[model samples]
Target: MKSLTFLLVFVPLLSVCRSQSETGVDEELGDEEHVELFTTATTKLAAATSDFGYNLYRALASQDASSNVLLAPLSVSTVLTQLSMGASETAERQLYRALRYHTLQDPQLHNTLRDLLTSTGTTGKGLSTAARVYLSRRLRVKPEFLRLVEQQFGTAPKQLMGGAKDLKDINDWVSQGTGGKVQRFLTKPFPRNTGVNTVSAAHFKGKWENGFSQSNSLESFQIDGGTTVRVPMMHQDNYPVKMGVDSDLSCTIAQIQMQDSVSIFVFLPNDVSANLTTLEESLTAEFVQDLSMTLLPAEVSLMLPVLSFSSTNELQPLLADLGLSDWLTSPGLEKITAQPVKLGTVNHKVVMEMVAEGNRYASSTSPPSHLALRVDKPFLFLVRDESSGALLLVGRMVNPKNLRI
Candidate 1:
């Protein structure tokens, strides 16, 4: 897609468990004194998060192969990492393993996360991430936990009295974070005994270095073997694009240029007869990096269907399947406070819009040729931040006619 916009909303289901007794105290900030930036550990964490994201993608895609699936991999991973800061020994272990950061120590893992977030902002992309923990006024939250939240995640824990107005406040925060792309993330009223609530959101709209024209025309898109739909496909000819084929997955990969040190890579299968399962299963951070190296630049004619869709996914079941089970049931978060608590719900929602932009190149550099790459069927695409090598968004367009935007 030419212009891609993504919004990710992550809200942990926070309900209290008053029956259990827990006793613990805050550990001193001993890790901070010894914390140092570990580049190798950071690189490993990036690769691990990508692997975890792909695994989660396959699980989500298996639910409905014909339906579209869009996700912000970095956003979800960062949220889980933040939650780990207050987790006890066993719970933190499961979280680290699930996030693919089991090999990293506490200090190294957090420092790398801080650096990664910083690098993305400096790259000039329209990317933003915000996280907050909302606690009930009745509970006495530990000062150390609040301090770590501010020092590491850059946000303080906010106290909520619990009502419709408090829900509106949280939604307002989400709306402001996503630039109004997500107006109301929390759709239901808060439970009467709701003790803790955590929200994480990310928004991204990348700039194109060589832009596309605003003009668009209706084109035929193959939804499946016996289905065809007409969508407003955007066109740009004589643009230099890197194209290649992945024989293992029976798909062609095309790297499209964008401004602000990033690019959108498209995975179009050879034909509609092929499904995205094979390609989705084969995805990994290393595989994508290697595939990027194999692309050969060529003057190409492109036809990409305009895709804009919003989706919401509940992640509690998926998190359990990924081995982070404690947070859902018997969460041992003694560091946050002495109160016995468990995560209530972990819901993720997104609102995305992809639109045409300026026509920077007035004329084509090469003559119109017979060769072209038209994405007319089910295909997958990803927006990657080149500066820090982070995958910003992953999406699959199965039926272009059913755009939710």
Candidate 2:
């Protein structure tokens, strides 16, 4: 049997705030009503995909609780769902179940995804996503499947000749997709007996709505073993932000806006010695949606670390652990080609950097007020698209100095 490979890359952007008001109009109506129906479908699809991303992140974090973790769950779920279109009935069922899409009653999954891609890829938002499929040179793809993938996912299958040039082509394609932010995504050679491969990338470079001052100071960061390290921390006073405390999770949540309809929600545990396991496990699409609505607006002295890091992770083992072992072992993707193919490996890479670069400020050396919220310890953050309610990235920052995964 031949092996299929999946590659995903995500660069940092931000996240969204969701509204639950539903329109109760009938679907069978005029053009305006059709637009409303499409909007509703895409909204529901975004929520479903976000839930899948949260589940995948929890599974990945469970593997190594101490290490820094970063991933673009939306990109991963998008590529996998795109691949599922070519899967056989049994294989499709397993894939949908793993992705948490089996419970959705909507039949236009592909159409909804197309709408989502269009909505989130708006210009000037500093956010973009793309997907492509590559096939072994020997196998011939079905024309109908090619048309469907091209029309929905915006790319057709290409031939992989299994050489170094093929690797360069893949990397170049990824670089172009992410506007050169993510270059050389695949550093290693493709495995033997590779059959089909899918590549997806998302990139976003965002600025804060209320910019932080360029003048930053080194602050003490508390890590494990009763030790502390000084790191450059961006500071701003009297910043308008949504702040709240989740008693159930025992953490302080802060939502900061960016240029576009994007927000970054920071979850800082009340105790520096607290473990983020409980907070991480408690994240779901519905949970985050409700939590965003309840946060009260407040102005506080804010300090955030200058974070820039990237990680490359092999997700095959994680997916297998998440109850998709059979699908990976025998992914009947017959629609792509007549040849037998199984999922061999899944590779995911993420690059994120949040900096202070919106407005200039005069230098000031003053003590932080009592209402200051300094992110000086381990914390979790979610970058989302507020317009579509899509999760752009989910990350855990433990040791900023150590960027390796």
Candidate 3:
């Protein structure tokens, strides 16, 4: 199938830190030793986050199957894990259960997070992730918490004055963190007496391993059951990529390789009669792992619609819907501060693009026999960090014409 280039971004609200009293500093590992540590910790983290991501997506899809949806489960979990570090007993229980952290106990969770973020930001990679907590200047955050955050997350809490200028500064900080892909992340004014605001951001931009044909053309796109719109479709003939089918879900799975160490997997239903719910519910870290192991490479002609969109969701309601309800109350954050502290307007924003950029198309060769795959209808896709097998960005495209840029 044709190679697709996509840029995916996710912004999630959450905060966290390490603990000096609860846990001692972990010994540093050498390159070889760290690789093993990362592999173990990341695998456990991936399982928890993947379960949470699929669960969250299921909740979103239930409300509006025809609307475009995007999110970064890793982003949310990473920030929440940090929040859990300082959470009171009640709040910590809820957060840990929601993240499925109970399944695996990685003593070096904080150190592993540090390594993961550092590894993903190496030069030439198209992915980056960041998390930080903004505390009110009036509050006295624990010194132990501050030290751990600085040592583990690599960023210290910034004092928020709770003014328009401070909001502008936070937005600007997010924009710069994501390479200007996301701006105005916080549009609403900071609430009075806001004690803590957690923020997480992730961005990825990658080119196709085999560049798509630059000759883009207009084609019919099925936004939903009753709507049809024309959209720019990029095409490539005899593209080599891994392909598979999950008959139980009645969908075709294709893994498109990126120039960097990443892959985008698209799940397009076999036809209009196919069930999207079945496919979505079946997604898990283990399923993806199996697919990657079994996917066979083959030459195929592909047609995919271009998409650029952004979506924002209020995370409080969604988190509640997912059984993380206690965070909306006074006792939810007793451990965070002596003063009563409750969550306020936890928001998530996602920006994505599938434009062809800096592609170097190889000289055309004699055409070979190939299968044809055309994505003309609503579908679910995810951009994954190949090395860690973590889902960087997962989204559904219902209407290619509904451009949110």
Best-fitting candidate, measured by lDDT? 2
- Tens-place lDDT per residue, model 1, 233-331, is 877787667776655466778888777777789999988968788778777776676555556676567788876667777665777767666556876
- Candidate 3 lDDT over 1-405, as tens digits, reads 111122111123222222222234343332222222224787667666777877787787778876788886676677777777777777777887887777668777777666766665664557655566777778766767677667777677677876798879878887887788877888876678767767776666666777776535888876555668988887888776787665546677889887667788999986754557877877877677667665667667788877667776766567777787656564355445676666654556666766665357676676743477788898989887678777778888877885865
Q: TM-scores across all candidates?
A: 0.84, 0.85, 0.84
116-224, model 2: which lDDT tens digit per residue? 7777767645666656666777777788887887778777767687779888998888878777877678886567677766666666666778788643578888886
Candidate 1 lDDT at 248 equals 48
Error of 2 at 237 (Å): 0.4
lDDT of 1 at 51: 70
lDDT of each: 0.70, 0.74, 0.70
Error of 1 at 327 (Å): 4.9
Which segments of candidate 1 are over 4 A away from where they belong?
1-41, 136-138, 191-196
Position 49, candidate 3: lDDT = 74
